[model samples]
Target: MKDQHINRRDFLNIVGITAATTTAALYGCAPKDQKSSGSKASSPVPTDQMTYRSFPSLGEDKVSLLGYGCMRWPTIPSPDGKGDLIDQDAVNELVDYAIAHGVNYFDTSPVYVQGWSEKATGIALSRHPRESYYLATKLSNFSNYTRENSLAMYRRSFSELQTDYLDYYLLHSIGGGEGMKTFNDRYVDNGMMDFLMKEREAGRIRRLGWSFHGSSDVFDEVLALHDKYHWDFVQIQMNYVDWRHATGRNVNGEYLYQELEKRNIPAIIMEPLLGGRLSNVPQHIMMRLKERRPEDSVASWAFRFAGSPELVLTALSGMTYMEHLQDNIRTYSPLVPLTDEDKEFLEETAQLMIKYPTIPCNDCKYCMPCPYAIDIPAVLLHYNKCVNEGNVPKSRTDENYREARRAFLVGYDRSVPKLRQADHCVGCDQCNEHCPQSIDIPKELQRIDQFVEQLKQETL
Candidate 1:
């Protein structure tokens, strides 16, 4: 117990703030320019030809291989000190920039950004002609299981997106054990799939598919039914890390792209950088990539890895600022597909990246409302941030970290008055089923609980 008590000074010595600050500086964390109200100011559009990737299964039109994921929108100080708005002005500018640069795809969902995603996405894309870009969203039927509820959720997407038709519509996240049960209950048992197919025939949905999270066996079953439905596209968690690792029970011992390739289904790649994990590579890996491509940014390596093949239809990245948008556009403007040597190097690097064993939470916020009121995602995020900053020891000692944990746990305790803490998960293995990243949610929570308890003892 005494050994576990890491002091602030010693922790800082191990994980230097200077390195983290340097990393942030090199990565470009500039705030985006806000658009003016009265005047229609000319925006900075890309002068170069945007790189494109074709979805032959859907159409001959080539979309910018880099699609913008409108999930993590910018937040501002709330007027009432509660929460933030969607930052529409900045979002609109990003939309404008992406469209101008030939990025024809924008992916959103009903659950993203506290349920404001569809509305914000609608407002932003409405500024441009609907035909100029393709819009992708999910069914997000996690909260609703019955056919009536599912249909309502689907219909709500149309109104929120401000569109009569959906270019690409996914079944949200499919795979995890509990998620499979929910899928069976909502779509299968309730005949939601039958309704969706009819809607597709009615032209409301141009392409129909689902995003996958776990179990390759389940993926196979879905593919087996694909011939009957002719799923136009499928989205999968396909970063360099998950390619080789066992992607939970639902993944069926196969990489997502491999499964898609087997079915000839075009794969829409999500989390190319594994939720910014790949973006903040360790110094050794960073040096390796930098040595190879001196001018390329750290993010460029991720895009390069994702853009390596022709099988991938779209690689979605959630860009919060204009510079991130610009940098991504530059990476994809003249897309450099990775060579064989590059692929080999990235594969090795990815193997090394996973060795750190950070929690697999992708910040999807599905396991939120932690009946105990815990800010599960925030806690995990802070943990990962500390790990990446090489300040895990310091993170254990820092008052700020302790405060964040305390605030989150206190909030959780208040909200979910009857629920148990992370320590009380009981290993029922219930929540793991709903997770998109296939995280052992209860296990991680227990670990955090243990650490928190240990911290308390140390302080005493």
Candidate 2:
């Protein structure tokens, strides 16, 4: 009910800017080896070489500093193309590699990868000894907040994961627009809160918490109940860029982390790479970090930032390929928490990044099939990539405009198929309601489409 929260909400409503891309690629990996999900006996990673952070609340369990985010499992193109099939064998190999490399925690939700991630994750993890690792899943009932339905979804998480009990469980995305209303219908009104808390007491749920995605007001509300709920942990979106400038609908990571820290709560960091923005930044920015550590991947810097904070229990990354998995494991296998000067340099880098008009699209695919088949995230991501590269064509008259226009157009056509490009948007708005970032999808689609048309007419 605070006016400030409402004001910020209104500002977002007016501009309708959508940010982050839904999909990302590992620049240095091949999927050929991933064609099959066969598990291999990965070489052991020395215990000292792997990073582990403990949460006293969870007892002697020391969570791996690098938690596997299971949302972006590799998929095979469905024969129909309307629905992609997860390559279960590929997923199996990835899990084996992660566990052998000392990753013990895996996080997934019911809605990830079109509800197939949990099953894929389950099959892979179940192959290993149960005591070797931990499992986490969610009650991601974004709609239909009925008790009956919520309970059914909660139970299904266990069934799909092939686990009798979950090491960690969550009330997913509790702080989007209408967060309070949704929370009430999904938890309080339906008595789901009492039911879940009881599950924790009974050990079926070893630990319980939620992932926050909106205003500080909503975050405060949940923490206020900590005395009764004893929330074992909290997941938050955090990165160097978002640590200070949350930009539109997001609660800044600084505030979110501080609040959790005040209560002695362990923080689970999400979006550390800012949906791949930090790793794929403009070359100038990349050079600043490259000058410091030429051998490290750009992603290692972001992951280290997330891990540096004393209160953070673990940082999550969605490793879709072997290269991604290997790189992250190497980074965390021995993380070097940032120094004060290092933090300052990152803060400066963030300020420079803000000048670019890149859209923040996490490519969660919450807004998909576009009702009109527009690949909304991919188009915006392509545009953002160009922006970072200083290729946003402003005029055909500019000296480098010809080169810039070609870069944007060619990248757009390649990244998104002609059939699914932004040109096809019908503006039905079905995708908006699901966007936690509250992006005005139609507006972004139109904006990008206009740019695409201009390039086409002027260049060709």
Candidate 3:
């Protein structure tokens, strides 16, 4: 598989074969041939390489501006039901394609792909010389707050990534008020920050920072401490949709990016496509974008948006297939910075996007293995999808939307443990701190639970 080169036909066929099984598992439906149903894998749209953007703050690495995020690696069948394990062969090919085309940075973490990300990233990156690429991972201590656990997680990241040094290391998923306290206790009080600083001095860690998931206040508190710590770079959720949405303090009339810029910190962007939501736009949004650039893929718009600024250090996308990697490379190869008019249109679109409020989870899976066995993120994702499609009925009299609601509700119940349902949200708010969108996760879960109850009662 290392030497294999799959052509477009073979690639399409592989996608066709796996699309059914993977989509069904992801969406909780029986495998069906949906290729003929208007979701056909389109050919790679061509674009020049001059359109890509780069950030000087990152030492002028000439990154594609669009990075390859490794959280959602394509999984194969396994007994544990988490997509057996990563398909290493496919992964290697994807990485190679991205690197060959000047994508220098690859971002992974301890929890991505159920703890397989680091190992897979190691394997994929080991194929190339160390200096040829830059690697990024996070000190993901979300599950364990003790300083010991945090240190162990960092060491494990080193071992799993098969490298002695990390190009960039971040505190993963910082969110929620209480969760912020946990961060303070775990790192600030427990000497973890001092340890990371020492690691940076030892050259084991190049740049030190954190990825954000809480409100503007949380962001402010962290930045306020910056004069003391002098963080080299920070990662944040930045996308056209989230640019000024209800989450990210944008809806509350706060500007997240401006705050970062104010402090002179470079921002590593996550969720540039909003968990792939922006990759494939609805017909209406698609029409508007196409009116401007008819030949572009829906995803190109996202890369363009990210590249429009020089402040963004790197924009990450989870590329599972070679073609997906290739498409992203083409989109960013010769970056197209959005014009001022394009920026205004996107800002307006962001306003329109808020009308359909989906759970802000990026599917990072920081909140996993719900003690009660609920697939919390999966349930939220499906519900969000239904909302984005406008399949939810305003009134019970709308049978079509109502039926769609029933299908999703019944499917949710069948797919997740009853105890694990959103109703089980103990208001712990543990998941909220890790979410970059600053969603009121427990509250949203409660709302979903109530909606499910109403749907069940209606059918009765």
Best by lDDT: 2
Report the alpha-carbon TM-score of model 1 versus the true structure: 0.79
Write model 3 residue lDDT over 1-460, tens digit each, in one string: 2323434434333322111112222111222232211121365434335344445555555545767788867656543343345666677777877777778788999877767778777877877888877899998776577888988899998887878999888987665447568678768888899999999889999888888766676777887888888888888777787776645433232276788888778778877777656754455766777676776666777777876666777788876555556656766666767889888988887776666666666666666545544566766776766666665556766758666777777667665556557877778766665555566777888888888877777752
Q: Candidate 3: which stretches are off by over 4 Å? A: 1-60, 79-83, 175-181, 248-254, 280-282, 399-460
The number of clashing residue pairs in each candidate reads 13, 12, 15
lDDT, model 1, position 411: 41
> lDDT of candidate 2?
0.79
Local accuracy by lDDT, each model: 0.68, 0.79, 0.68
lDDT of 2 by residue, 1-460 (tens): 1111123233222221122223445321112353211121143334458899887787987889999999877765544445456666677778878888889999999888766778777767877777788888888888778889999999998888888899989888888757688788878889999999889889899989989888888889878989988999999999999999888889889999999999999999989988778877888887888788777767788889999998888899887777667777777878888999999999999999898887777666677546666777777777777888888978667789888888888878777788888878878888888887778888898899998887887734
What's the CA error at residue 20 for candidate 1, in Å?
25
Misplaced by over 4 Å in model 2 are: 1-23, 26-48, 80-83
Lowest lDDT 10-residue stretch of candidate 3? 18-27
- TM-score (all chains, Cα) for each model: 0.79, 0.90, 0.80
Q: For this target, which candidate reaches the highest TM-score against the unseen true structure?
A: 2
Q: Global lDDT for candidate 1? A: 0.68
* Model 1 deviation from the true structure expressed as Cα RMSD, one decimal place: 11.8
Name the lDDT value of residue 176 in candidate 2: 70
lDDT of 1 by residue, 275-327 (tens): 76676666677777778777677778888778766788888988876666777
